[model samples]
Target: MSFDGRLLSGISVLAAVVQSRNFARAADVLGITASGVSRAIGRLEERVGVRLLDRTTRSMVLTDEGRLFYEQVAPLLFGIEEAAVSASGAGGVARGRLRVDIDPYFLRSQLSGRLGGFLRAHPELTLELVTRDHVGDLVTDGIDVAVRFGEPVVASAIARKLMETRVLTVASPGYLKKHGRPVHPSDIAGHHCIQFFDPVTRRPFDWEFHRGRKVLPVATLSRLYVSDVGTMVNECLAGTGIAQVLAIRIQPLLESGRLIDLFPDWSGETFPLYALYPSRNHQPAKVRAFVDFVSKVIREPPAHR
Candidate 1:
């Protein structure tokens, strides 16, 4: 109910501990002694009248109540930090740590090559990329923004639509040489297609082709099933099977003739990429900087050499 001096200090220390997962490390972050950090948490727990954390010599974990408390507390803490940063940056310059949650494939395939330029431009900014199979709790994980391809899952967060990438069906030259390219959507059933899973279904995405108002669904023969985007691309490159992937991800390979679009005419299917933040209001400057950078990258892809 109130931001008393001790309560605010305790909250900051608690957030640091949860993030770093160790008292000594948290103390280093807070610039306080480990014993001080301990006393602060003890006071916070006593003030809250619940056990927030259970600690042993080797590890410290959030208790059930602690987890619930953190779910509510972390967002408030993030908002306070964002407010401080906004007020501090009168010139609107982006600074401080900007942690982003993104998928591994997006990181390696899209941002990894261009990140050096971003870092060089904002010398004061500290960027942390947390690559996950699924989006984590933005506030609890201390993530500033989550850029991913799919629907936004966090209902309370602000969602910004970046761009839609086309779904493409591709195969290697060697595979085409051996099995021949499918001339029609129906022909896909006879080819050795590489199956990539749908995260929601935990099964291979159904093969679908679209052209104008027409849609065709094919039951294809998949020789192998892959759980990862990188694996699907690698296997396709090795001429194992045909793969369905986002065009943005395989643009270079397509330009190099390493991968051929099997159904270029049927590339009407697309997926949305969204940038999600913890709150709709009070967005920090650092968050805006990264999101703008992402949009620029998507709009102007690197030319394939």
Candidate 2:
């Protein structure tokens, strides 16, 4: 007949864990100790008559029943948060937790050095930036927006094309001096090239160069294959091998003379950057603020991207 306030507290703790993905992070968000967070979850599990989280020393995940419970509870939590924001007259402000899924290369090359301004502008928002290779379930992962290159994987979400950056095949001067620059794309066969995998295809992306309307698909050789673009860039810079990278990502290096664009004339190939969000309607202010900040940060002079 009466409301159990403790149940609400437990639900809040559960939501925190789902958003933060660990007891320590959840504890920080809730302003409680890690042990306190664990106790809260224990009490919550006892009350619910099933284990909501399967926890190991290194990681934790929602059980099947836990995920179902979370699915039912998540909408209620969102409603409560919206109502609270409205009641406090901060509904339109970017004042809540903002979880962003970003590409590792974009984070390192573009957003890392520029985020201080955004953080200063939105002091009330807690920004969690997660670097991922693929766009997973946004709601289940608690991701507010995904900033990535290439196309959107899911049809349900909204996708905004931010910019298209040219792809350049580059090598350090040291590597080129030793192996000689490839005048033609086919000459790339003899040189060691850093391979970046296509997360969707589960194989290293086949190297391709474009000049005008001509497309040259090179069967490149690689002694090193990196899973992320940042690492591939580093490997290229280290004289390990030639790498095909987004031009905007390495424009500074090219200008600094640390890495040379093997064929600047072959810069016709381009990759598009996109911001994908869970919904088109009632999008959170935090998501909009972040997406806009990213747009401004990564866009280059028309020549660069």
Candidate 3:
């Protein structure tokens, strides 16, 4: 069959089924009945002269042909969606779904309070927040924006610097009293240190510190290793060991005297936080509004020390 004669609707239906992995679930997502969905897939297979799906009483599975078809058409569907969003008249109101990927710690500590205000400003917009430490493909994952710490290596998206993150090495006051605070970077090797395991690297992250005009690295004698920053903070609060975390995330603990900054003379490197999106041109209203709000929040001067 000619491409012009092919039904894009059938392609979309097939894609939804493959993505959702169930005919009923796909139907619910596409606002159609399960039988209707099955008919659409049947018609699609007939037109293409290929069996696209393997169906059983319990579940639906995509055949090899279906997988290949989905891979080829998903990108085209995404492009069409983007084009439609771009052509939409935004007016002064933000509408439609705004999908965002962000780190859990940053979202909870920084963005949580501000999100209420943002939602109030754009009542028509629906927010879908995905909290994860690892970065994901915005296009393939159908994410509208991503808030990430440090630098992003992905060249496909447009990355805008949101803010600079200040990191600090800290421990609970009790832990410090028991283990004795390290006066210098080299002294850390003598103490029981908390190690942060990078999820992406699957290895322990090196401890970073500053000494006068030079940078110092400390190899830790890890008593505890954790992947989540929240858990690391909790461990430090419970007097487990010293941890390196974003200063903002631990500011309240520091102020409350529950956590003490170790080696006051040394500070870790400042990492850039960025907001990445699929493209700058023809951005959707919801995405544009979110980026603007987030940027404004980041631009606000840090509180006086």
Which run of 10 residues does model 3 get worst, by summed lDDT? 296-305
- Model 2 per-residue lDDT at 128: 87
- lDDT rank order: 1, 2, 3
Candidate 3, superposed: residue stretches over 4 Å from native:
1-26, 35-92, 153-157, 211-213, 278-282, 301-305
lDDT digits (tens) for residues 190-296 of candidate 3? 87778888788889887888756789887888868888888888988998888888876767777888988876678747778888876435556687799888777
Write the residue-wise lDDT of candidate 1 on 100-150 in tens digits.
998789889888878989999888899988986777666556667999888
lDDT of 1: 0.84
Give one digit per residue, the lDDT tens place, for model 2 in 191-299.
8988898887788887888899999888977788768777888888889999988887888899889999888887899999998876435566788889888887765
Give me the runs in candidate 2 sitting further than 4 Å from their true place.
Answer: 1-14, 22-60, 63-80, 132-137, 154-157, 199-201, 279-281, 300-305
Error of 3 at 195 (Å): 0.9
TM-score of each: 0.88, 0.76, 0.76
> How many collisions per candidate?
0, 0, 0
RMSD of each: 2.6, 4.3, 4.4
TM-score of model 2 vs. true structure:
0.76
Candidate 1 regions exceeding 4 Å error are: 1-3, 54-68, 86-91, 154-157, 199-201, 301-305
